[model samples]
Target: MSDTTATPTRPVNWTAISITAAVVMGGILAALLAVAPRDDGGIAWFDPMIPGGWMAWTLPVAIFFWCIASLLVTFTILAIRFPETPRVGVLRIETTRGDRLFISLLGSAFICLVWLFFAGLPVWGALALCLVYAAAVFRWV
Candidate 1:
């Protein structure tokens, strides 16, 4: 047979890709929620080496910004590589991945805000809630 290795394969399964995108975004959201500090008037910092003894509010915020930057990179990649079939589906929107990421981000932000308000949990306690939130979102959603 003639060599045709240079020929490109069929298009990727955007549906599956979108799902993964959703999951990843969700995970990032969970991480942000978990790391964010609670509103309680207690100092939550401790030995950095210890497992859960110490954590600062800025850590999660920094992580959140990083994840957002990564998502931006992913968007750029998809836009450049798949310029033709960019949209996932009409039902989802022009870009389903973007939509999902937006929703996940918003939801996580909302959760964080709520925790910041009502729970009044200390930094350590918020960390526990964040872990549970991440688990539930990943497993259920």
Candidate 2:
């Protein structure tokens, strides 16, 4: 009988991963608070978070970057823990988890652009469609 399990090149340093996750989460929380509008006008430390109208940094843009960072971190952890081998999917080409992630992200971007052209802003509906599209890509593509 032949063994199938692939051995990891190096042991995963769980402490480092945990610390990284904590830092990522902390940054996200800090960003959220920074963009939050307060009735006190953000004067004192206890007043509230930072001013939202600081340069080009908007709440939505911050959240988007945070989400992207979180996804990358999650995928990195999964790769370290599971170590996937590229497999052929519906596309009849070998693809790893990272490849699927890339495809989904690219497709989602296109879907948003097309949806914007036809449906206009408040992209909640487009977001739902993108979620479905991403699920489909991860499942079969």
Candidate 3:
């Protein structure tokens, strides 16, 4: 008898991947652009003729990137440590490495948005968010 352990087929979910990439990239870009604003102790108006103004824009992007990195590392660690767990929802999830990555990146964006809504936020916010995300992902996904 011939061995018949065929490779499992992957779902053709290009749309999901595309949307994920677009949202993540867009958020990062917006954040970077809003990173810095030059102020020389004077009232400065919007001037397209300025040079360093572009630097201010990089802040948001930097924060977004930082969030992503923080989430990725945090989730990876948790997923390995905890292994698989049942969630409060109607599904039991096995924490795969790929799932960990996806959840981390996506959840990081949401956490960053929430932080932004509550005035000036810090990198710690992102770190904390990653921790919560790791738990939630372990439970749910």
- For TM-score, the strongest prediction is 2
lDDT of 3 at 57: 30
TM-score of each model, in listed order? 0.37, 0.72, 0.35
Candidate that would win on lDDT: 2
Pairs that collide in candidate 1 are none
Which regions in candidate 2 have their CA more than 4 angstroms from the true location?
Answer: 1-23, 39-55
Cα lDDT of model 1 by residue, 70-121, tens digit = 7786776676556644354423445444554565566666676777797765
lDDT for every model? 0.59, 0.80, 0.59
lDDT of 1 at 126: 57
Q: TM-score order of candidates, best first?
A: 2, 1, 3
Scanning candidate 3 in windows of ten residues, the lowest lDDT window is: 42-51
lDDT of 1: 0.59
lDDT of 2: 0.80
Candidate 3 Cα errors over 4 Å, as ranges? 1-95, 135-140
Question: Candidate 3 at residue 27, lDDT?
Answer: 76
User: What tens digits encode model 2's per-residue C-alpha lDDT throughout 1-141?
Assistant: 999999879866988987889797888768686656555575233332345545555556666777888888888988987899999999999998899999999999999999899999879999999999899988997
